[model samples]
Target: MTRIQSHPVLGNTSERLRVPFYFDENLYEGYESETIAAALLANGVRMLRVHEESGTPRGLYCNIGHCMECRVTVNGESSVRACLTTIENNMKIYSGQQLPNPVKRMVEQE
Candidate 1:
């Protein structure tokens, strides 16, 4: 993965903190100031998740959070937008088919 040390418009990103995160059990380094998608892309991880229905491979699309193509399970939470979620230290990210009702549960009645 290559990082732009200097840019004409954005300038240098060297000042950003290099935080360690995990993607499917593998360790990788990324800047804490950027989103999870950006960090994954920087690490050459393009395949975020597969299509839940057809089982086709998918990656980042319409990176402004308008598309759900970049959904990834972040730290036990499924169907999280990689483009919208920021990279946190030691984050456990997973890429696979989206699980149904991952955050929902039936309440027990008294």
Candidate 2:
């Protein structure tokens, strides 16, 4: 189920190799060098993260990097724009983790 078992356009998506990673404390299997958003989407992770203002869920709105709707925090960096970032082995992504302490303090201070 980790690999693309079925697809309309790119039938039976093939990958170079499978790699393990964590997203917000959840372990996920994906291929190396693939976009994190692509791997998440392939595994039915529709909501990458939420908007700060409206709390609206968002995902790969654009496959390319232009839309910025698929923003996520990879390894503590916020607003990573997932569609543009490729997945790496043992990548500890923080898509749904609580905001960083500094950012939380900054927000509270504001």
Write candidate 2's Cα lDDT for 15-46 as tens digits: 36777877878888877667898888767788
Question: TM-scores, in order shown?
Answer: 0.82, 0.73
Candidate number achieving the greatest TM-score relative to the actual structure: 1
Candidate 1: residue 52 Cα off by (Å): 0.6
Report how far residue 25 has shifted in candidate 2, in Å. Answer: 0.7
TM-score of 2: 0.73
**What count of clashes does model 2 give?**
0
lDDT of 2: 0.74
Number of clashing pairs per prediction, in order: 0, 0
* Candidate 1: tens digits of C-alpha lDDT, residues 19-104: 99999999989886778998899899989998876678899989999979998889999889999999999999999774454334
lDDT (C-alpha) at residue 3 in model 2: 57
Which 10 consecutive positions of candidate 2 have the poorest summed lDDT? 95-104
Off by over 4 Å in 2: 2-15, 96-110
